[model samples]
Target: MTTKFGFTLMSIQEFETWIDARQLARTVLTIQEHHTYSPAYTQFNGSNHFALQQGMKNYHVNANGWSDIGQHFTTFPDGTIMTGRSLEKSPACVVGQNANAICIENLGNFDSGKDAMTPAHRDTIIRITAKLCKRFRLPVNTNSIVYHHWFDLSTGERNNGTKNNKTCPGTSFFGGNKVADCVANFLPLVTQAGAPAAPVISASAVLKYVSVTASSLNIRTKPNASSPKATDRDAAALGAILRVYKETNGWYKISGSQEHWVLGKYTTDVKRATVKADTLNARSGPGTTFQKLGSYTKGQELFIVKEQNGWCKVNMDDRWVSKDYLVFA
Candidate 1:
């Protein structure tokens, strides 16, 4: 149950620390540092302020605050990479399960009617993603990475329709193919046989464009480092425009921002995207489940270590779990 990024297999705790830290060394800035407001923020009419604050508080509680175990690892917008929960710990970012995946918080209101993210933000996310892919051995492609919306438990209603009526990451974020594209861009860097080919972008090429339907994306600079120089960047607000430049080893080196990288799995490309349940309660038997065994829910993105019949055998929270409990989005 582990997610490989570069040569590293970040445990749940390590991943959580990364989110709280907001390691920007691997991030890029989409919008310039001094911007007025984010379009996505304005569009989200829900409790965006409450959401952000609550998310931050929750992250702290699960990883930093009372828990002191660090749950998430990083936060976008300010581009600061703080450390959070350990690989063995769990987080509260998501409902029901988070024992495996590290939840990252991107500042801004995603539910708002407008898009709040910028290209620079994407660049940062791509590079960080690329590095993680190489470290954990997870596929850098979009197929493995997923959005908050896409993460659904087996007990919850299908397609994110649940009786609890929870709204995570918001509809604006992780709405469409954007998460896929992010993973796609980063996968190449890790999968490349050797050094990646030079960026195939032209200076005259217009900035590639994608809508930041979500409130935020995890942006990085070098993919695996933590430095203020690399972390410095304005948050990607809603409705902000961005341009794509070139793809590198498991990363999308953006053109709009100085030089930023985003994880390949979070983009719109046609990488295989699927949603899986966190450590599903395993039973000695069946029917409403039998005895509850240990559980896992590690890694932001996981590689399909193995799969079979209606089930996919995958690493759980950097460990192994039963495939029968898994379900795709």
Candidate 2:
């Protein structure tokens, strides 16, 4: 294991042990898969992992204005897994759906006909995913493991990669980024990823999850915005998740014990739902005439943030799907 620039670089073997010993403070219901589209395979000459990681942190903190790197970890083409943001904090990867999630930024552009993934990189992705599943006691399915391509970029809703989505983790990633592709090509591998022991779960006291919509949400000492800022942390970056324990007068108690709170107006409630249809159309508007954005496959799960006209607005965005095909949980 290696540590540099406030990040830890570890081999897959080392990561397995490291993850097992961690005492994560928040619940992790899902694992996010992403790709560093810019620093594609071509940029990796094998010894620059630390430099690349620092560069990404610089971009996320300075350019994106995030509190830290957007992901919890980054998987490289050489199969190294480098730690980024704190595991205790929610990732800033997907909008609105980032709470209770762990993000993995794979170092490659896996778009169609681009960045032929190396064998080492491919193996690390699968193993890391499986290990996390086992560690979290999460079901090995599309809902628990997600691809960045499935969400709308602006609203952070899961519309199955409809319009306004970036083909992240790419279209050709592990066969493809489609939900069907995950069910067909990726999930089965995760199910068989490790020694097949019954998973041991670590419980969390989180009541529900909320995503910070405000570019920078203040962490108040009390439920109101007028309260002083928390001493430990000043702000919660947009797309970060807050583990809500209680609510009061448009404010949510984000900390379990302390008075850390944030205004509810800047955060949207998230609901997880599964598609009942073999293929459901996500539209630009609530009606059929709006525009067919994309199709969601049966059993695929996504986050819904709004409801209107018999349609569910996904991830607080313009993408809507017929409510007739949804089964909420």
Query: Evaluated with lDDT, which candidate comes out highest?
Result: 2
- 20-41 in candidate 2: lDDT tens per residue? 8764434476899999998888
Q: Where's the lowest-lDDT run of ten residues in candidate 1?
A: 27-36
Q: Please, what is the TM-score per model? A: 0.38, 0.66
Error of 2 at 171 (Å): 1.4
Q: lDDT by residue for model 1 over 123-184, one digit each (tens)?
A: 44444444444333344333334344433443221133233333434444433223343335
Question: Which residue runs does candidate 1 get wrong by more than 4 Å?
Answer: 1-55, 58-70, 112-115, 141-143, 152-167, 174-285, 288-329
Residue 102, candidate 1: C-alpha displacement in angstroms: 2.4
Cα lDDT listed for each candidate:
0.37, 0.81
Off by over 4 Å in 2: 195-329
Q: Please give the clash total of every predicted structure, in order.
A: 137, 1
